[model samples]
Target: MGQRVLFIGLNYAPEHTGIAPYTSGMAQSLAAAGWDVGVVTGLPHYPQWQVHAGYERGHQNRDIINGVPVERVPHPVPGNAGLARRLGMEIMFGLRAARARWNNPDAVVVVSPALFASVIVRLRAKYHGIPVLAWVQDIYTAGLTETGSAGGFATRAMRAVEGRFLRSCEGMVVIHDRFAQYVQRVLGVDPARVHTVRNWTHIGPSTHMDPATLRERFGWPMEDIIVLHTGNMGAKQDLGNVAAAAARADQSGAPVRFVLVGGGRQRPLLEELAAHAPRFEVLPSVDDETYSALLGAADVLLVNERPGLTEMCVPSKLTSYFTAGRPVLAAVEAQSPSAFEVASADAGMRVPPGDPRALLAGALTLHGQWVESGGTRHSGGARYVREVLSRDAATKAFIAALNAVRTKGHAPTRTTTIATLNN
Candidate 1:
């Protein structure tokens, strides 16, 4: 616990979904595993896209959560974020978050959402003669292009910015194997310095949640088969397919009910789709215990990604889905890293991304299997995740990367500005 581990991110706990949970989990797990952890992040505002009460343009503050120290910097809450709006918010966070000086850490891990914050981390770590690890959750340049935000020249410029800071970092961690490849091959980073650290489920254990109580609360009949998707309803999630699937399932007189629980700009679109579907329901985000309970009570957990998002990220919700002990139905790109991960886990089925028919068929297949087995699909998800993809495994890998970079030595100190961020 002697060495200090600093995590810099725009997202953190109380945000509930997306990279926030993982960032919080990583810092807490690292602390539990005998590292003194610290985090510098912005005020919590996500999923709902509004700042949580009590922290409106709040000044920078410090507190400890689960034995790890956290310093939060205040910034404007960017609701229903567009690329330009998000960029402005992240820039504000990067400047303010970097202003807080703590005792020199042995290493710093920078999380993306504010990807350019890596520059702040790299320069700060260099000043202290420590290593910097870029914990990449998304490839922003490709994300922009895939999401139709930027074009040829803008994409090239963004890529150059990404490449510069990534190459400058002492080490890097990507959440999926494909990400590692992109970092090394596309970003031109040293493959030897890039490591794959898969994200783990964020939902707590289902023990405290009584399935009967939860089902009763939701007013779902025992005969109803629940198919649920839980997480941020962001644009990258091709969730329109889910609503369309729900409508198809309802028309066919299936007893299955589709439930979507979370927040984001796309939520309204999903809600509108749900409205005409006889059995479709959309619930706002719930408390941690209730969320876990919902996961457990669900007969099938769904992972639906919009087309082209495969190049951006692997949905982190799959981890929680696997841990829920329910069979998963991942409607993602056939060759996506998510599809590959689910294939390896043996807990789910993958259909092509953005296909309503495929998503409906997969859900029906899982439902039929469950009914035939007397409601016992006997998921392999829990076991697979426990042995192969636990957060503890990620903690170990992160520590190993830190050690590797520390042993390799740090770059000489120098201020790196965004002007020089483009390689």
Candidate 2:
């Protein structure tokens, strides 16, 4: 029998956006690679922040998804979860995960975003003498800064707590190089233990769909350019800027229809803002087929971030956007990881965040390119996806990292003690 490996994460399959897809993909890929794999995750509820259908708030469910055994625990799904509520949800998940049957797996990979939960799981793993690796999707300290959340005690407490847990991990996997740097530098982790494995496109290849037909079916004008932003409309996403840009386009009579498809805490606010903009449309999340078709049909894919949010995340949508062979327009800080990904792939244009005029101008420029190149111009993104974001490559690298963590027989070497930075 293959070596046993277990994944502990808060998100999993059936929630097809955000971190869930990646976690599910990684877990399944490991299973396919001949490892005995199991997952301990929460009942699906994300982006919408409401419990998924058929999942009760107090029940523990077990199921097999794509051949991987999954054990799910109940966690709070706050309607509009603020920081305290979000933290509470994470803490609850942590407590539940700690109580779940680990079955003495060879190694444990814990996903973070539920930073507090990871700490809890890691502490428990230590008790069992199981090597623990951290799959850090985002840094909580950076999140506090980017979201303009209350700091001081909260920030210091998070940094110290996160630092202690991360440093103690047998290995850490980060999706972007920037994230690795932050983990090593800011979190005081040993550089050698941090691995950079770029996230692959979790969505399958999009089947070809005629743009005109899709636009017609969706009631989008044929003459206008379609600018689509799909995924969470959270505060960090700064979709308010997208709505503002759409309103500007409508007011100026630009032949562009801006569409947002997905849910988040900020969706209601975006709907209100777009109500007066005839060219703007807001749609709920669609099935995978429809989502991929929409990506194929759109003239431009967009990534918008709050002006000051330079870290904490690399938009997972970019991987899908790059694979869709469509031009991308990023409205974000130039130095942010999302901007770097866009620029690195040569996928699309970048405009400063929070500037509706700049976003409108960038979209117009991409529209011009779309017209001039007959829509075959986004080869850069396609090539980058093929070259950099291959599932096989990512899976192999992650498995190697996990194997190292599982096989390492000695204590993790520590470089520096956790620093309590006071701002």
Candidate 3:
């Protein structure tokens, strides 16, 4: 029989954004490669933060998606829950995940973001003599501290708990080298146990569309320079800076319009902040076709981060932006992973985070280039996507890492066994 593996994560298929895509992609690829794969995941309720259509909030069910069986558990869909409520939800999901049917398997892969869930699942699997490999999407402790979401005492406690969870795993996979360094230095994990696998663009191909026609379709201004930012508008994004820049653009008559598309805990706050800025608009998230159309229609794609949010995550939006073959302008720390991706790909320019003036200036500069060059400046981002972010390469690397973990076997667990003797 082929090797069997189970994936435990809070997010999975049907949610195309954030950690869901990577987790779903990895599971499907493994199933396609002849490994017996099953997933224990929550009902789809990611960037939208609400249960998807046809899915109930508290129902537990089982089904197959793309040839892989999944055990879907229900958890609270918090739109803007406080830190305490959010942690409560995570713990609830973790407890339910531990109760999910466990297929006898060679190994298990635990996806983080639901950091507490990883620990819960790992301990459960270890009890059954199964080795687990952690797929760290974002550092939980770093996120809490960097976003100022938790106090110093709380952050330090989380760090210790999270570190212990990761150390107990057989191996770990991170999306970037910077994350691996943080794991080794701050979390005190063995360097050899960590692996790096860059995330691939999960969006469909973007085609060239007439800017005027798309602008009309999306109800955007025809004459204004469009600087678009898509995906989650959470605390880490610090989109308030973008609103401030748009207000400045309006005052200076820069002919620039800043649009944010997507939903998150911060959307209402962003809407209120951008209320007075004429050039700033917030739109609801759209379907894939409209999303692609919007990307093709924009003069520049943008990424904005909070001032000190240096290492929590590498925005998944960059992969899509690069695939759209448009130039990017990032308002992030100079040494962040987002800045590195932009600079290394020669795809766009970066300005200091939280500086509204710098962001506006950078957008204007990209706009000038677009106008002078007739939008023909196809940046190196697309090429980087092809050469470095290929889905096939990523999947193969993940499978190899999984196999390595499986081969090591789980540490011996002391379990009582009853024996019968016949006279």
Winning model by lDDT: 2
Model 3 stretches with alpha carbons more than 4 Å out: 208-210, 371-378, 411-423
Number of the predicted model whose TM-score against the real structure is largest: 2
lDDT of 2 by residue, 202-319 (tens): 7665676676788899998778889999999888888877888888887898888889999999989888877877888889999888888899888899998899878789999999
Global local distance difference test of model 2: 0.87
Say which prediction, candidate 1 or candidate 3, comes out ahead on lDDT: 3
Regions of candidate 2 where Cα sits further than 4 Å from its true position? 376-378, 409-423
TM-score of each: 0.92, 0.95, 0.94
lDDT, candidate 1, 1-423, per-residue tens? 467878999888878788998889988887887888899988888888888887757577788877888889888777768877787787778877666764566677889758766676566566556678888998888688777777788889889999988998888889888988888888899998898888887776688878888899998888888889988887777677788888877888877788999998888887887777778889999888888889988888888888876677888788888888788888888777888878888877877878877878888888778668774563777887888778788889878888877665444442233123323
- Model 3 clashing residue pairs (backbone): none
lDDT per model, in order?
A: 0.80, 0.87, 0.86
- lDDT-superior candidate, 2 or 3: 2
Residue 399, model 3: Cα distance from true site in angstroms: 0.9
Task: Give the winner by TM-score: 1 or 3.
Answer: 3
On a 0 to 100 scale, what is the lDDT of residue 409 in model 3? 67
What's the CA error at residue 371 for candidate 1, in Å? 3.0
Clashes of each: 1, 0, 0
> Model 1 segments beyond 4 Å from truth?
374-378, 408-423
